[model samples]
Target: MGPELPAALRAAVEALLEGASRKDLARRSAQVSNTYRGGGSSATAIVEDADATAYVLSRLPATYAAVAAALDEVRVAAPDFAPASLLDAGAGPGGASWAALEAWPRIAEARLLDASPVFLETARRLAAAGPAALAGAEMRRGDLTQPGEGWRAADLVVTSYALAEIPSERLEAAVRGLWAACAGVLVIVEPGTPAGTARVLAARELAMREGAMVLAPCAHQQACPLAAPDWCHFAQRLPRGRDHRLAKGADAPFEDEKHAYVALARPDVCRAAPAARVLSPPRAGKPGLEFRLCTPGGIERRFVARRDRAAYAAHRRLRWGDRVEDA
Candidate 1:
């Protein structure tokens, strides 16, 4: 509980639920009969929006915890980074942005860029609700493909679950441009799917090329689960009537499907080459362990030996160059 967090924030949520019964929220949402069905919001995306908000609001106290953790990881990796303002890409109804704000109170101003007017309106409403700092935010209508001058200014940048939607050709360039604009840090989040994983991989590569470092989910390269025909989406369940039945219909307990990508931005920082050193035999009853290569990047990257053979082979283990796990 940060001292800056207002007491009204909790009060508002409590009041919001008081008027709309959780059961009603669930029933209407489940029925797939929202009044906004024929409206401009994407049929596929509204349920997503409803379920996402409901789930985050329901159980995840400070649902931004994951986002905050990612940001903290970045802070640990790069202690000199800080931001007074932010530019958020694909600011889907401002959910992740709010999460980021919770993690980084140092940011006082923000600008949300997205292609949806409905999303912008929702962002406005959410901002007005309790996050007083959000009052400094403004919305933009374009994206990486045709972003206007409005997208170019910021101390921090965030691309949360918005990059995969961008065309393949523009992905790298967009990442570079985003880093180029960052005065402090950049955080990118996608889903845990194969396609999402692939996009995250590409983003990591692009970020490294531009001098940024990986701060979380340390494994940058991983197998994509969605590369095949199988579905690769995560589900977030929403309880009944805890949501806006007018917006969600009778679908009491609904589920939100999503792919996520979370990454951090820093000035191009690279780890040094691995130091080559010989290992000594263990004493007494200690199990024989050998072939440990240390890197100048400062991580005790260890390798288990198999009959004097290391799983990673006899190689220089750079801090991050050696693929150990997912980031």
Candidate 2:
């Protein structure tokens, strides 16, 4: 099955509708969407309790799915990484923390940091029924752009879809602060748009310069092989719950959240990196399967013809964002 919100989290989010007006939720949901579309941040959009609820109902599921998908890559790259603590920066409704808890059950402590009081409050309510670790997480108010010594260190640090809010001048410093607090691994996730890819690439470069190892999506720390017109990204298709569909007024039962992410680890904690990662879906034909992969050697297009039965069979099962043993 594809990535999904944990049952507890899904139920908690759905329960939020018990006393809410559907009309207000839909209108506020649209406002939040428009604000983001117009380059505004959640700090400006989520000003009240209703706005926060609307955001949770409309966004929590997709956010959880995207972060979970990214964490799956981390699991593959470093199988032995059993984190005991997590720091969710710019945590909106604590979705990334929930995803981390689901990915690594060993996580016993979590801290969620966000600037919006409304989002932090909403996150607290949603997390009340979540995993024990997340339910007791520390919710702190802070600006990601000005991260300082006040931030606590953790084994797993994640900043999902939050970097876009930092101004260009302060982005590198924000990334640096996050790296400083990362005792083990740091994962940054963004929307899959070209602009989002640019932000991820920038953060990836900054982290690498500070001695961080590229753990996923890239086999080598060298410059991203894909040029501008073409960027690296992946999609996670999540099943929408009834409240989710109604909040957004959408008929589709599922939504595809396209995201671009970079997972980095302190050099000492880096484990077995993948030989290659499938950059896009493989093309299957009667003749063979063509795969575009990111390998240590660089971006390569490899063709496995049906004649190579073993390799073809092994590759046929691979999909976009999957790790490959050979490229």
Candidate 3:
């Protein structure tokens, strides 16, 4: 299961949909989806306020769930990380900011940056009814491909689903800017597709080369264990409400947002990497449970037989996307 959208945030989003034509919103939603599926970015797809509204109705919850899940791993790796300021780069309607506030309530300041004016204004509207920090947060419009004016350092910096939009040549510079602004932890989340995983891996490598420590997903900073045709990713299942269903023209009550992420900290930060990360759903059998894990050594499959009562009981409830010290 994944985290649900905060009640206040949900209500605010629903209010935005009021008086808008559902038919129009659905059409815009389709256009946005098609653009993204075709390797386009929201900067071009979400041009108008209505398009931004449609995005909130159709994608906000899932994006929030994915960011929250990725931030949870950051929390696990850095329990003492109590960030006071947050920077949500490429923030669309402030979903990542909301998710960050939920994870770190003590955060006193938030800054959202995006390339779309519609999304920035929509984010402000939605944040008006959100937590105090978010409601009064600064909203700025900036393109990721362009050189930033040296962003202020924040305790936590997140760029979710925005890296794919940068041209290949400019991506390294974009990541450098993000790392430059991060004071505590940096979390990068992308769609769960193989292409998304490749972006995350590239960022991970660049960050490490710049003296960043790997915090989650990988216990060791060695090369990714999973080879081509098999990429690293995780799923977060979020509930879809009536407005969400209507805007997306779907009947399903929920959607699984598959995401690839990397959480890294400054080299001075302590490392709390897991021993192994469960790569897929565990297989249950009369004998025991089978797990596919990414370990310090490499990708390996382990089986815990029922005869091993202690280990079996300890892992009976293990699920996919779970990090384990023993696998």
Candidate 4:
């Protein structure tokens, strides 16, 4: 955490943020597994909980903190890359997908693939209310284990905190499908653990063989290509504090979502040093604000505007929808 950020890392963020989503989607799938037969939430409850979680995450400070941690991992791993389109595998309530959108800009579109009707419905709502000022992302209800028919390549592919649900046998295929669909890059995130780290490393090898690159958590150097096996997991301390705990009605001090890997592939566009522009944070009174751009370490930086800035800064503010008065 004491490293000085590079310049390329800076531009990589801008290009990415331009394609980010309108709203930040926060999901807590651990609740499902903690209280279910499979230790995962029911499709119905997952969707319901997503609604509550998203609402709480909408709060400026809380949302920004969560988004920053997630984006930091991504930026560090896939610096200087700006994805065009994105696909979410096992999208669930589209939490990770929404986060990706919030980090990128005008992202042509995003496809959410999940087998739960409830999750799909919730995804539609979240995307509909997204910040991009577009028609929201597309939704396709399908299982990652069996992604038949409607499927295609994407600029960016992400499967966050959902791959653990599939059995080991099918996990490979899901990862493969995600890689195959990535024309630009593929990113997969899982819990931070020995087991979780194993899966992430395994996926990293598979994707790299197919032309992807490891953007972060290297902290090692065995050889050109890792031999035998390894783990690529990083954890972020999510201090729940009061505002969020009160909003979610939970008393958790912090959340250790475990180890996970987020990698980049294809790199649909290359604007490593597109422009030296500084983005202004939003006014405190504005609905919301998100700031992002490309960077050197293959990662992006994002944040919701501090409240004090949104007051009277109308045009410069960043958010999903705002009416403009023609002169």
lDDT of 1: 0.52
Off by over 4 Å in 2: none
lDDT of 2 by residue, 1-327 (tens): 467778898788778667999889989999999999899998799999899999988988888899999998899889889999999999988999999998998899999999999989989999999888988989999999777644679999999999988898999889999999999999999999999999999999999899999898898889898997999999888898777888899999999899999999998885884679899889999999999999999989999999999988888898888888865
Misplaced by over 4 Å in model 4 are 1-33, 36-70, 76-79, 133-135, 219-232, 239-256, 267-327
Give the Cα error of residue 260 in candidate 1, in Å: 5.8
Clashing pairs in 3: none
Q: Give me the candidate number with maximum lDDT.
A: 2
lDDT of 3 by residue, 102-178 (tens): 99999999999998888999999999999999999999888766646526889999999899898889989889889
Give per-candidate clash totals: 41, 0, 0, 63
* Model 4 RMSD in angstroms: 14.4
* Per-residue accuracy of model 1 over 1-327 as CA lDDT, tens digit each: 211123444444444445555664465344432422232222344454444344334322322433444455465555666667888777755665776676667788888887766556656656676455676688777666565675676777887766756778988777777777676677776655667667776777777776666554442323322234542222233333334333444354443334344454554533222222222111222333333222233324354444454632433232221223211
**What lDDT does candidate 2 reach at residue 268?**
86
Better of 1 and 3 by lDDT: 3
TM-score of each: 0.59, 0.96, 0.97, 0.60
What are the lDDT figures for the candidates, one per model? 0.52, 0.90, 0.89, 0.52
lDDT of 4 by residue, 264-312 (tens): 5464434122221112222333454444322232223344444545433
